[model samples]
Target: MTSPLANPLNRRLLGASALALVLSASGQAFAQTTPQTDETDDATTQLSLGKIVVSAGVEKIATDTPQAVTVLNQDDIDDTQASTIGDLLDDVPGVYTAGGASNLGQTFNIRGMTSNRGEVLMLVDGVENYFEGYRMGAFFSEPELYKRVEVLRGPSSSTLYGSGALAGVINFTTKDASDFLTGDDRFALRTRFGYESNGDGKLGSIIMATRPTEDVDLLIALNGRTSDDYEDGNGDVVTPSDASANSVLAKARYYIGGDRKHSVWASAQVWESDSYQLYDQITGFTAFGTVRRRTRDEAFAVGYDNSFEGNDLLDLKAQVSVSETLTDQDGIALASSLGYASEYSYSTVQARLENTSKFTLSPDWTAFVTAGLQYYSQERRNPRYKADGSPLSNGATTHPEGDTTRYGGFVQAEILWRDKLVITPGLRIDHTELSPGAGVVVGGGSTAVPEDATNTGYSPKLAVLYNLTDYLNVFGSVAHTERMPILDEVYSRSGTAPVNLNLDPEKSDNYELGASLTLRGLATSSDRLNAKLTAFNNTVENLITSASATSGYFINVGEAKYEGFEVEAEYATRSLFARASYATVDATNETTGVLLNTRPADELNLNLGYVLNSLDLTVGWRGEFVSGITNYNATTGAVSSTVDSYNVHDLYATWRPRSGSLAGMDVRVSVDNVLDDYVKNNLASFAGQGRSFKLSLGKTF
Candidate 1:
């Protein structure tokens, strides 16, 4: 079989062709309103062009950010009725998930970089969620706990997020008590229930929000879910897909100095699941046999914010957070041969202090400078036990234990000239050190300790955006960043490869160009349309990757190149809305000219909906199309088997009443995979979910 969108040149032409048509059509429309930096009200802030991005060092509207960015609000999250966090982001352009059908195995991929390689940064309420292990995945949390998610694509984010953000950054914001409070009401209680037919999945949740004092607000939420193994489109049961999980979220906020400008807040979240499943969660089943596994993930954070109302140069925010993820497995059928049951854990502690200064530089120039300092420490541990419940004498080097410490400081400056041109420049410096755990053994059972490895790197970026006209804007950016080695790459010295102490940091140079189009008064006087197209090229030097288990351990090989394009457009009115996005990426190893397997297939997502104000009802249809890919190997001049293209469609309806007897009630209904077509994500290891009907009901008092 042959793939249609596999050639790099063809993909580039496709993007160019689409862009030419969009530009031509937009030129004929007249501009009605000019864009502004003023923030929109909460009720109307969900609009794609009006939404503000808090993850950026200095908040800016998504369209004015000069990067490929996406923001999903609470409404979007609820409409999907997603079971896992990954499901909430699957439709985002340039984003994909691997690890197959099990929720526990889902991991995120951006551009062509996987999260396991520390290329993509994941954060929850400003705290890092870092975990990497064999056959396991990253980011295990409840999607119901979050109200907002922000995705900033490309290496330009490295200046604010971290050094390893070669692909991008994703930030999840938790819900607050204020989100549930209504006028004159000091307390609120909410109950929600949901069911899915495909896997017989059931979910129950309860939340309480209260204001004990005029200066304090508090909230607590509890959620539970259970499901059996689900069937694929062919009606075949996908083994090890059963799930039983519980989660809790608590948050509080307090005002100080009788002024809300000075406030403090804290939050805690915990999620856990215990069950018996296959030893290999990534691909489902293997010769390793099944095991009794229990997994726990927890995060806690505290923050302080002061507007400094009288001081224009002292607006400040500070935070400290800690997180831990642990997984334990016992009663393994192959415990004796594998040397025993084991426990794997990753713990992190982090802190950040940031401030933004806004001032006028001249009559025609306005500027804002943001500076921040961050520090984080992570530890990884793997302990094994004998079949008889005794400690193992020899440790496994395949997953060694280690500790990594990193600290960084960054500064960004944004300057606007006459409200038509914006320029942003940023710089960051980070230092990292890796230390092997005590008594850890490596290749050939050697006990000799190795010297600690340390490295320092810097990232710099510059971006410019110019408004060509009232309804069009062009932007370009250049960024250079670095990524330090993680614990696994530095400590694990197994599989016939010796320890390498001279490992160097991976460096990347990324470039991006894009255009934004905004038009109004086309279909109706109050309707608006917004679209953006972005093209990016990145080169990574000294790329770090595994050289196959039989050959060597993780090593810094030659360079790799990644190039891609993303197109996003949205149109909305009082009662009608439509959105569409398309994305494609091509990545290859420069040394052998072989296409990288991490590159995902081209994807297009579309949503069309209408609202009926009289009945307080909304209905929508969503469709997703994915093109297949064929891998190429230059060494042997061979082409690998291809993955067939597939398409999935969904229908949904939602009802919410604001007044009368049905006030404070919400109901949602959705049918997924309506055609029951056999589907498999190009990057996944197993088949996709089959046709299913889902219902969710909630009531607030």
Candidate 2:
């Protein structure tokens, strides 16, 4: 299907159709808000939820995994300028980034997996975390309310999760009462003022509080940010500056009796927002913005877990959520006769239960067994009709509305030997059934195609971790996974379907090895100084893409693979310290022999900190670079070219003075896009943020 960005009436909203040729790859924007620390800094390395308690798959695991996963803790995110997961993802290697501050329908590509037909899968506490539509891009989600981010790179991930995970999985784990389990009542408040280069003004805030009652614990978090349109490096106001979002997260947990051995945990959250697309009202618009392009969303969930006798583990979790999102210019038209239009929405409800046990299987080994089941229901609507009488909704046909039901079960086993070797093998099987589209039957007047497809798939993974020395550990892993097309692909009435659903599900296999090393003993005396590095090759078959066909749908293309390497290291010292990490990814189409159109090949991160007398100072820098790309036409070999390579650098500094009477107060200054790089890093359609600075004061109690 043609992109709304290509529509002449909507062209002004984005740049020119020519740039669309370039930005298809979701680009990454990574900046450093905190400085690196030396090994000496280890003496005071604070261990909190940010450092551990990672939620990667269908369950929570330690950050120390056999795969390439990056854990961004709450404290790090708290101090960073990034307001959402999209902002923080810019620094993670092998991950392509895109969308400005508020591009709801945008998607991210990890490895060589990206397209109008999405391949990436994102989850919030094991839920779909998607817009109403199956083909809808990443649902608009605010990051300030989250506890951490877990990104799994490459296919072969199924061991627990199934399809829609071809390239990777991004799990936005929310904060809970357990995360704030400090001894006393605590509260922290932060507020900031922002100014866009294109000329918009706004304010942002982050608030958190925890209270412990007689037998219960409560935690609360709040964050809000708003801004105006911004100009490019050349002084061009890319879009309207009006953007706003508000979110609240709360959790309550109670202890049984007084032993604290048996406790129950529950949590809930609400997120809502209305934003303006930063673009010319007249030039580029899919639909006019009389009412402004807007969307709304919300979610709620609760669960319980307890540790019992015999080292056995039992857990039960149930959650349900409803979300609605829409984008259109119903009352407002960018072009008079050429006025454009479109609307999309996603709503979902889900729940699941999981159990695991650790028991002695032999004299020399122990075993871990896990089992789980999940259910989901989602509805999507996309109307591509125009303001004036038009024959089609999205360049061709109108999208049908329907809901899909998905259910699945999984089990895994892990065994350890001699306290030096560990092996884990896991499997998951899924069954998905699409609720028939009774609204418009397929083959009706040839305007719509009726498709009710249901299929089952399997996911398996095997990994080995071995301790080679007292200070180092090495590991290797291989896994097979799959990705089933979303409801949008089988039934996108928008006529964007380049191919039809007869296409097979996408599948993948990954091979990798890496190591974790502890170096404080050899380096300058410090409590903890560690480093990790990994390299791998992952290839996918039948990669899905919009194609040219009679039944317009998605289908597997020639083989595509992503080969890359990553290195992330941190050192803390008593007086001063620094930390840095980088990744180089070569995502390419093996059939066409070109770099994956949307992914970058290089990234860099560095941070430094100093503590003197009663004051602490820090300097941080992050740089992201990318090569160019190639776009193709099914009928032709090479159709067009995209953005060239670009690099961005940022700096940040903050001071916390000794506070005897002040209790808790601090000031900070940050310079984003420090060089004012003017390159249009619009991953594909949306514009990018430019050089801007922020200053603020905050307090904690």
**Which candidate leads in lDDT?**
1
Q: Give Cα distance to truth, residue 235, candidate 2, Å.
A: 3.2
Quote the RMSD, in angstroms, for model 2.
8.7
* Candidate 2: tens digits of C-alpha lDDT, residues 335-391: 343235555555677777767777787888987777778777776655554566462
Off by over 4 Å in 1: 1-21, 31-46, 283-285, 393-395, 442-446, 548-552, 632-637
TM value for model 1: 0.95
Score every model by TM-score. Answer: 0.95, 0.82
Q: What is the lDDT of residue 214 in candidate 2?
A: 51
Worst 10 contiguous positions by lDDT, candidate 2: 24-33
Model 1: lDDT equals 0.81
